[model samples]
Target chain A: MGASLLVLMIPILYRIIMGPTGFDRILGVNVIGTKTAVILVIIGTLFDRVDMFVDFAIAYALLNFVGAIVVSRYFNRTVPLQEMEKPKPRRRAKV
Target chain B: MKRTAFILVLLIGLLLAWAARDFPAWGDPHSPASSSAVSSHFIANTGVDTEVPNMVTAVLADYRGFDTMFETVVVFIAGLAVFSILRGGPNRRTRDREFVVDFEPDLIVTNTVRLIVPVIQIFALYVLAHGHVSPGGGFQGGVAMGASFILIALSWDLKTALARFPIERCFTVAALGIVIYAGIGLLSMFLGGEFLDYAHLAKVFPVSPEMARYHAMLGVEIGVGFTVTAIMFALYAGLSTDGRMRDGL
Candidate 1:
């Protein structure tokens, strides 16, 4: 079951890697994070230690939520997404 | 340059994989680590010695406690270094930043976080207090607690979080944590045991020596929780605001 969830994350991983917009990447990462919590729980069930693993899953979920919020907060405006794909002229380093 | 770096990384990765092939199979009884007298002693006697069902916590907070105390100090030092480096230089806010976060807090996010923070904190305490019987301990609990504060900061603003846990007080709490850990150690020493010898606590605590060790482990864990919780939040505050303690990410 955990293996299946990991296999499913491949698409989300690709979305994260090839995402056009920053928001797309963020959403992809969030999806993967949520899936990871589920996977943790599945792993716990396999180990026959649901009680132990559930704590880990909860902590992982909380951290995942906090991470997504931090990223969204950092990119508080919509300007960066529009400008992200544009290439800037390279500046020479001053010696 | 990029190609060279990639090749270098590949070589290192291949070397690491080659090294990993020599490692013993998972949980192999004949593995060097499992066969060692030290590990066998811990496995067989941890319950008898400390009454702790979780050997990892017992080993961490009791048998090898001196090391854990120093680990907490290392965390404290890392926070201190970050705080000192970024704090109170000329304000860098005058310089243009790549991203400027808006001051407005979202109602939905804030409300949701308000609902969630208490649960997270209670769980943190559970993890801290329940370390002896399960997998959690001070470090995990402290991180959870710190994350709750960080969530508040994120949903609202840095100022709101700072208002709840001020910067100066962060250091104080951090130092106090170290003091609590060391104080217990010293008390044990004064009670006729070596430093961090929690068994000696049985003399004053009116419990069996094993139970004394168990309770002392909880005390030590609480101390570690305090330092970690404070330092984690402090590091976040310092790094996020570049130590200005003003507008933060």
Candidate 2:
């Protein structure tokens, strides 16, 4: 089962590399991130250490989720070029 | 330029791949690390010394405890570094007018988060507590706990997340984590054991030395977890808002 999931990651990798839009790339990365968790579990099973590996899988999935969210939120903004030009007042200056 | 970059990447990749051959094969008993008497002693004695089933946890939190303590300190420093370097405080400008965040909270995402946050937090606790018998420890569990908050921020807004965990509270909690770890070490010292010696804790608690180490390990893990979880959220809060606690990305 994990092997098939890993094989499926090849297509996701292709999308991450070749996706036309940034959103497509993000989606591809997220898919691949999730599959990596599954792969970690499979590796754990191979080592006869599923209990230890399950914790890893859970942590990996959590990190993957946070990474996707951070990326999406970053791109969610369209910062105005005009706003970029205006320097806000600097309050933390020292004499 | 893109082609040149790709070629360089492939070159580096192939170099790394070539270098991988020197690494000892997986689980090779004769590997330098595996064959060392130090590791041999650890493998033979961790159960007897610590009464801990998980060798990794026993070695990490007990034997090389000073290293792990410093590692937690490193994590604490990382949180501080992010705050000092990236945090700009909440932008007052964002208060007067609408801050542009190109997306709105989708109902589906927010609702899903509401349902799953409890489950995630509970699982994080399980992972943190179960480290002795399993693969997890403070770092993994802390990241999981922090990730749930990040998810809340992602699904709703930073404001909503902060309502549950304020910025001041973030720093306080982070400090508390380190103190918990160090306190255990200090207590052991006062009890005539070396610093971080869990066996010393047996004097204070009415338990066998072995059981004292077991429980002390759990306490130390929780301390590490606390620091990590706090730092994780604090880093997010700082980086996301550019230090202005308002209107995060």
Candidate 3:
């Protein structure tokens, strides 16, 4: 069950690299990260070694989170060139 | 191109499945995992090490507590990373609009959530307390508690829901939990048991060695539960708020 999910990674990575739109690439990366986390858990089960792999899975889950956040933060908004020229606001005088 | 890639992946999957033909069946009684050194440690020590009944919990919170402490830390770091990456700066505008509770919230869900929140909280504590004797432990309970927050989020608007439990305090608590765990470990060293040794606690209490270990395990489980719950909630907050905007979580 887990291996099949990992196999999907190849295609996802391919899309992330070749997709024409930034949105597609971001979606692909997020999907890949989610799958990576599940795969890590399965691999931990596969080897029957709980010590390091479970920790690695937990860590990888976090990494996937961080990756998703960083990617999202990157494309959240694009500042228009005109906005850069706005004058700074003056502080209000204290009563 | 899609077809080509699909076919490639299919072929690879087939090859991998064929190779797995010789692999041991899942949960096989004779599998090395069931018989290995690590499993042996749990099976052997569980009976005498602590009075707790759950072997897996014992392993997670007791014998291998050092690893568990770091695991909580990992969760904390993940929360901080998410908060730092996506949260608006302090000077940036905060969401001012009140999160109005929907009037026609699903009747079953609204009532169920209201009723179940307390039950779930009790269940989490049960899992934490019985970790030594049961299958569920700090991590499982922590996630369960986190799910309660998610339930709250789904019931109400994010702003109103989050106001009840601020993310910043959650992060701080998570960090503090780990610091407390480490402090105990340092205290253990002073008592002349290895770092994180609970034997000293027993000595201080004039209790049996076994009881000391049990007490120590409980302390660590508390930390694990705190950190894991806080971090999981933070991650859920981050993902739900901004995944669609910037990247998919």
lDDT (CA) per prediction: 0.89, 0.85, 0.69
lDDT by residue for model 2 over A10-54, one digit each (tens)? 888898888777788888877788878889989988989887778
Ranking by TM-score: 1, 2, 3
> Model 1, which residues run further than 4 Å from truth?
A77-95, B1-5, B88-101
Q: Report the C-alpha displacement of residue B240, candidate 2, in angstroms.
A: 1.2
User: Model 2, B1-249: lDDT tens per residue?
Assistant: 999999999999999999999999998999999999999999999899888899999999998889999999999999988887764446523434335555578777678778778878989999899899887889888988999998998878888999999988988898898999999999999999999998988887999999999899999999999999999998988987777777777
Compose the digit string of candidate 1's lDDT tens values, residues A35-59.
8889889988888999889988888
Predictions' DockQ, in order = 0.28, 0.29, 0.03
The number of residue pairs in model 2 that clash at the backbone is 6
Q: By lDDT, is 2 or 3 better?
A: 2
Error of 1 at A75 (Å): 0.7
- Rank by lDDT, descending? 1, 2, 3
Give the deviation of candidate 2 from the true structure as CA RMSD. 7.7
Q: Whose DockQ is higher: candidate 2's or candidate 3's? A: 2
After superposing candidate 3 on the true structure, give the runs of residues whose Cα lies further than 4 Å from its correct spot: A1-95, B25-29, B88-109, B243-249
How high is the lDDT of residue A57 in model 2?
Answer: 79
- Candidates 1 and 2, the one with greater TM-score: 1
- TM-score for model 3? 0.63
